[model samples]
Target: MYQLKESRKLSNTEMKECLQISKSEFLEQINLECSGCISALKDFITLNRKDQFISIDQDIKLNDDLINSQRIFKTFAKLQSFGESIKSIISSIFKKTAPQNNKKRCQLHSLKQNPEINIQEHVHYICNEIVNQNEDCIIQDKEFDYHLQNYLKTKKFCPSCKENIQAALKHFKLQVPQPDCACSIICFIKYDHLKCEIHIPYDPILLNALLNKAQIQPFYQHASTKEDAQEELLICIGLLIKDRLSSLYRETQTQEIIKYIFYQQIGEIFKRRLENYSKMKGEHKSQLEELEQYLKKEVEQKDKQKKKRQLKKQKRKEQQLSFDGSVRANYLQESSRRSISPSNSEKNLLKSFGWQGSPSVSPQTRKELEFLQKEHLQEINNRRKQLREQTKQCWCEWCHHHKQK
Candidate 1:
């Protein structure tokens, strides 16, 4: 009773003394553990005193057989333990590394096949994790951990599964270091874009359309593994929506337009945004931050180009004004030169006719010629004045409406 209960061994004589019982009585009263112990003890120490210390060949052979039996049992036990350990090690390796027959799809696929699922909760959690990452800059801070704890209790969830996925989400949930993983971060950015940037809320039709489009995009269709491609897609989709809004339907409250845009732009936008993110930040970080940096770089580049264009435009305008001023200066100079009166010899009609004396025509004829000359000069001056007025109307810097009529 003491050996079995206390999980310890005592010599047969000690056991007998403690029980105050004989060997025969102990044997008769033995339980399961005590019987096994007694049997093992008897096998190891056979009390064959028939040849005690006599050094007989039979006695030595029996002792050798007993030692061999014990040695065989010990070796067999070690081998059994080694085999079990190898089996456990193999099972663990397959469990951790295998992809469940290669059927496991990413979060997008989960959302896609089961469109009826309320992703609003997932979206809410993503946003909360991002908004409060604590002082550690680690996304899975105490607050986030507490929220997850609260969430698991309040909300029931089965493991994320598909035709490809066989394991429970809890398995990966424990393994992932951050609650704000790429997929979740992307979802948070989408929520922020919808709520903060677009300033619209509760558009069931539009939200459904966007989510469905996300599943179809290549970025979403790709298998979720080591790579964080969902973040790329999220940035692209958000950008696409914003670009669509700014370009086409900014203020219109139309769900149809959003749906149309969703289908039209998702693929192209996904690719473009992925390329941009790779160019801007490489694979350094996997959060909304990668998208943010890409967008900031794009904006800075655009601003730089815009300033360059403005400067070029300003330079071209200045050059054109300078050329116009020089042309006008030469024209005015010619006009002033033309305004001088005719010389004395050019005013005499008699000189032109080769008559030296002033006796070829009557005063009335001269008066008529002078009147004709004055009228011709007046008409020429009037035409020049009209041309100047038309040029001013067409080319005047202050006249914005000159091209209208």
Candidate 2:
């Protein structure tokens, strides 16, 4: 057993040699027909004693034949678990040893009948021929699958498929698939060469249903390269024709000319679209004109109101200034009269008493009188000048009165 444990750590060649020796020794000790069971015993003992050796002589007094049989069963079980073609052997073992329950019997039968199914068989078979033919065949397959799936989702036919369908439709008068409904995956595989007796027959319901499934709608042609130049020029010509027709229709009321123009424009639907767009633009322009007139009227009214407020404020300020000037003038006149009247009586008394008095006036009073008179005249002149300046600058009712004077 220790030797068997040691053999487990050996390389494959050394281990095989040790196993052969073990097998020979077991068959000799057993004294039974060597039914290749000794080889299984060697293998079993080696595996069981891999981490620790068993004292086979002391622990068990089993006959060599019994040990050999037990090892054979272990080997059979291991092979049944791992071998691809051992399902029948396992089923036989289970029928002889397993409990006689219906469920267990059914399970055993299932294991025997269906061995392990290989999921990769279909994938490998589909790709094997291509892989054998080309060195980079796997990469091409992956790219094709990617493009095919994208074509399915986008409803856009591959270039070759589209060209084939276009030619078929043109030559045979068969209807081409509408742009929205063209599922390249299904169409390429199934319907690229579909036949119909009509030329460009429209099928709105079927087309819309397929488009919904593919999650795509008709896309407008984009003029991104020289290849699209002819289409772009055609669109421009259509626009020009629509504009001329619209102008003529607006300028003339003749039914015959209008009918001719309508028929001519019908061949180019893009021209009709442009005409509708132009009419919408004209309606927007008329609305904008009305808004501009309303805004202009509001601005003029605001300006007039602003001017009226300014004139009213100017009139109030001028009235305050004139009232202030009049009060000042009246106060000055009263003060002068009081000063002169007192002096006049004093002078008359002095003259009748024959007293020689110096005009019966003090030098201070004369000086005060002179100062008051000068101040009054100066104030009057200043008020008149202020009124004249205000009248020149102001456009108010009070200032206008001053201006007329």
Candidate 3:
């Protein structure tokens, strides 16, 4: 909130903290000091941060000296009542030195020599009787020829003499003649037998009809791109309009009409193109939708076929499991009966070794055989479980792939 008001006054404590001084020092330096003195002290401290106070003070003194000097000069001028005489004096000095700096002589030396004569009358007489009459300075009079030679000298003249010469030569300069009639245009036909050239007048209306017929002829169909064709057609039409206007109307109002017509034609072309684009877009959209529907139907059919295959595989697995179980039961029963009754070869070998009656199966041996059979059955069950798990993972992976597709 304190920061919100940039011009907020600081408290005495805040001021002391900012100044890094005790209360007594702050009071001595700030409270008792005049506002100007305080501001001056603050400026001195600010300038002294980079040890620049001495240089700044010297600069201030120099500026003060400059201002005082200007004041003294102004006062002195006022006391002297110079008014605007200083400018006149400076101009007079330049004028006095000008002739000495410039060494160029006058072209019309005769005119410069006879300064007391009527220069205007002399110039008028030379223009009318000599220049206009002969169209050149081919004078029969020796005195006039001498003056003309002086006028034609290869030397620059002073400003006054140059002015007189320019006045005299003004008659020879090409001047745009003012039209006697209001409309300032002059039309004429010229035939040059040397060039075998003849002028033929063309009918603007007939040319316009021919141009219109040519414009209507189909050419856009042969162009590479529609936009290029349109641009070319527009250029041709614009050129045609320009040519027609050149001989028909040459005004800004008609130019505006041509522009409006051009823009209208462009708008119509763009509108037709936009409508065609929209129609094409619609057709493409419909085609894409049909493709999507067809793809969906294919996916459904594939899923059904996969489900049928999985069901068949599962049925075959179940049947194989049941058959294996029955076969295992029969095998276990046969092994038990064989264990209870010794084989004939084993009985003969026992008899030869003086074994009496049927060899009694040991209880330990029976227990061991049963334990082995149980282990084999557990192994078979584990293998079947692993096969079932592998089938389940394969099915899951197929489903994931199908979903992605």
Best prediction by TM-score: 3
* Tens digits of per-residue lDDT for model 3, 1-405: 222121123333332222132223322433211233333334443342212111122121112221232242332234234324433422322223232222232111212321222222223333343333323211123433344335324233354444444443232122233435323111111222344332211323322332443345443223334333333333333233334333232222223232332223222332233334445556777999999999999999999999999999999999999999998897767656664765575455456557686455545545654565567679899999999999999999999999999
Q: Write the per-residue lDDT of candidate 2 for residues 287-395, one digit (tens) a residue.
A: 9999999999999999999999999999999999999999888666655555443366445544554656444344455575566656767989999999998886766
Residues 190-274 of candidate 1 have per-residue lDDT tens digits of: 2221222222222333434445544443423332342323333332343343333322221121222222222222223322332
Runs of candidate 3 with Cα error greater than 4 angstroms are 1-257, 329-340, 344-405
Q: What lDDT does the true structure give each of the candidates?
A: 0.37, 0.38, 0.39
Range of the 10 consecutive residues with the lowest summed lDDT in candidate 3: 52-61
Report clash pairs, candidate 1: 103-164, 104-164
Off by over 4 Å in 2: 1-272, 338-405
Candidate 2: deviation at residue 148, Å? Answer: 39
lDDT for predicted candidate 3 compared with the true structure: 0.39
Evaluation by TM-score, superior candidate among 2 and 3: 3
Clashing pairs in 3: none
Q: In candidate 3, residue 260 scores what lDDT?
A: 31
Q: TM-score order of candidates, best first?
A: 3, 2, 1
